[model samples]
Target: MNLSILYRGPLSSCNYACPYCPFAKRRETPAELAYDRRCLERFVSWVATRTGDSIGVLFTPWGEALIRKWYQSALVTLSSLPHVRKAAIQTNLSCQLDWVDACDKAKLALWCTFHPGETSRERFLAQCRVLLQRGVRFSVGVVGLKEHLAEIEALRRELPAEVYLWVNAYKRQREYYTPEMIADLTRIDPLFPLNNTFHASRGHSCRAGASVIAVDGEGTIRRCHFIPTPIGNIYDPNFADSLYERPCTNDTCGCHIGYVHLDRLKLYDTFGDGVLERIPYGFGESKPFLENLSHAHLSTE
Candidate 1:
């Protein structure tokens, strides 16, 4: 079976202090960092044993992970595994880039996010250029805050046309984005409209527990991060038996990581093998895919 795992460890610390995030500027104690390291090592070891299944891993840490040496080492190690199809992470791109050269570029990808005020656009773009030079597959994105619209548009203009730039809508407040603002952002990212909607997902068929799972540092597994009920632990011998098609229990899912798995959305067709990295299939190709956006059936509760 081809299994996709979103692993989040206990390392909740970041270098930047973005106003919108709770974890902003939070630092972990030495003991806490050591605990996170141990958990990650155990998870990586567990992944190495899953030779019977084709595995893809995305490190969806609460804080920035790439800044830590352990995460970088883990990516390099995981990418080299023959059974691992892809090893990627959601990162702020604030770390050094030389380590990427040690990884198997074909199996390694990155989901890079740009914070407008936290990091200058030029610095982030330079990092992206290094990744491009290294032949790494990645997608760049920004949180769709109204204040950052100008920076977002400028980023789209400066980035290579082949690179896919995505936008995550700010949904903290109701009606956060005006229709005209949405339209402007949508023009830059055709997929922005989908991200802006709070998808009504309760009782909807989703691929979460079956083929895709959210795993924590302790190996506890759930349908996804938004759901708290644990189906099983990854360390359990019978864990594979617990995985099966399950409907979402939440009223709505706004996060891309959670909503993209809704079978009705058919996002797998939109993303193809790049689902974990958040890159659309046929991205950077002709604009024909934009015409089929309605087929995703985006809706809210």
Candidate 2:
């Protein structure tokens, strides 16, 4: 069976001092660098061993990963493989874009978040233009703070229509978004309503263990990012044992990567095979997503 791996190890170091994030404005040490390399090597080798199945990898780092040279090498190497359908990462768009030209355009993607104070909009848009010229798939996003309202609108205007722009709801102040505020953001991010809040998923069926998984630098496999308890190790001989149906221990699910896998949300069908590279959102002249919601509602009744 094909699988999606959310690799999130080698985390907690970042180049920008975003006030909201804990892992900000730090650099990796020599020891940290070595550890990251070794873990990636093991992961690459593990992928080589999985000849029977195709895999998609998303490097969900807490820090800025594109700044690291080894990550560039790994992404290049992974994208070249035939069995790897997708090898993408979440980045702050602070790194150079010339290196991205070497990776497989069809399989490589980026989930980029725009930090207002850390980098100017000009620099950010320049990198995005490079991706577009290279035919690389990516989605741009920002934390939906009221202060960023103008910047968000400007971003939508500058970016091409094919490139999807997303809005990340500020978790701390979600309750503060009045009907008017949500209406405003929804104009910027078509799927803002779904993304602006958490979904109650205590007993819903999900694709977490069956195919989607969150892996750490140490190869520890959790059902998904939200749950940190170890289900198994990827290197174990019988690591497949870890895959099973399990209920979410938490009541609410946020975060795009985590929230997308909730089966009850019907995102699995909405995104189809493009969930790793694209977000399913369209506010104007696009109502299929909303239509899907209604279809999903009738199916259960």
Candidate 3:
């Protein structure tokens, strides 16, 4: 069976200082960094041994991971593995683009986030252009802060139409956006309303433990990131026996990575093979899937 692993290591430091993010500008000591590196190497080595199963990995670190050299090497290593279907990561696009040249473009994808104040728009766009020129599969997104609405709109316009630009709803405050504001963002990103709502996920069927899972630095595996209960460990020999369909135990799942896997949402049909990388099927084409949004049956409470 094909398995999708959302791997988050112990690396929790970032160079950008986004006000809303807890990990912003956080610094890790040399010892901590070394430990994180070892954890990541162990995870990658474990992935390499899973030749009998098709594996797809997405590194969802607390801080920006692409900025580190080890992450770059890991992606390069994972992308070349014949058993690895895809190797992607959540990055801030702060790292140099040269490393991607060594990766197998077919299996290497990136989920890039654009922070307005952290970097200049021109610089970010330039990096995107490089990715485009390199034929790298990627998706760009930004937090839907009211203050950054103008920047978000400008980014959508400036980016290539083929490149999907997504907006992540800023839900830190209650009713943070007005109806008009939602409409404006919706026009830019047809999927905005979906991200804007908090999904009630308790007792809901999800594919987390069965086909997808979240793995921490120590190889502890959980159904998903929102749930802390350990279902198994990736290093355990009989770990495959523990995977099965399970209901979400959390009252709410607001994060895209968590809620997208809810069976009731039918997002798997929406994203198809691109779910791990956050790319919608036929995104740049005619986008025939957009016509089926009404049928997704997502419950937003």
Candidate 4:
């Protein structure tokens, strides 16, 4: 069974300056701004019609999602859907507490990340408390590094037990994991061990075109949000089927959204083994990487 229905959209502007994040420079345009609500409504309606097991829908944004003007309408629309049991948001936790309260009201689990340069540890913990009191199931996402260990530990203690805490490995822009980084994270947070078990293993074997779906601001169904890749328009008649058949050819597919989707699909080996072998030497475009991986697969056969 898959932890399916990852409804990720890049529909916000961030205030952080994280050097390692791929979407660090993301910003929404005027045209893109108005499309999120419509796309989200259509997407949720489509998801509700699907008869399936419990699915988790993640509203992961490139920037601080709470700051987006259309965030509330999108949240209300997605949360109100009948089929979605678990709806979550991945945010920087830099927004005001009211947004946390809104998330709580909508029964959306909050996944907040702690960035030293963006927000202080104290403030992050305070927001955690707000989420807890509001009856929201939440987690603190710690960037896996020695320097952030103390703060993560402190937050673990200060926050409630139900507020699940996890440690995430540091991902530099457009780069996959090194064995060294994995080793380091294993050493740091043993209880919350985070291996690049999702995308690092799966690589280009993404079934995003087949089953997973992401909608951009213009109501277009994209393969994944990391690149400006679109497979079909959600407004089309065969949108779901169209997205379910998209493919990826990325060099290293350990991106957060891609990896999360991989993990949801329980395709860790597809991410890990594929990533290590498929990533080509040339720097530009994913086609060459796909070609190389195809050759490697043919040779194995």
Task: Assess the local accuracy of residue 39 in candidate 4 as a C-alpha lDDT between 0 and 100.
Answer: 62
Which 10 consecutive residues of model 2 have the lowest summed lDDT?
292-301
lDDT of 1 by residue, 156-183 (tens): 9999998999999988899888889989
Candidate 4 ranges beyond 4 A from true positions = 1-12, 19-56, 99-107, 173-184, 187-207, 226-229, 243-248, 263-301
**Candidate 4 local lDDT, 4-84, one digit each (tens):** 444655465677877766557577687776676566666666656654535456676666776664565555555666555
Candidate 1 regions exceeding 4 Å error are 291-294
Scored against the true structure, residue 132 in model 1 reaches a CA lDDT of 95
Tell me which of candidates 1 and 4 scores higher on lDDT. 1
Estimated TM-score for each candidate: 0.97, 0.93, 0.97, 0.65
Clashing pairs in 2: none
Cα lDDT, all candidates: 0.92, 0.81, 0.91, 0.54
TM-score of candidate 4 relative to the true fold: 0.65
The residue-by-residue lDDT of candidate 3 on 45-116, one tens digit each, is: 999999999999999999998989999999999999999999999999999999999999999999999999
Among the numbered candidates, top lDDT falls to 1
What CA RMSD would candidate 1 show? 1.2
lDDT of 2: 0.81
RMSD of each: 1.2, 2.7, 1.1, 10.2
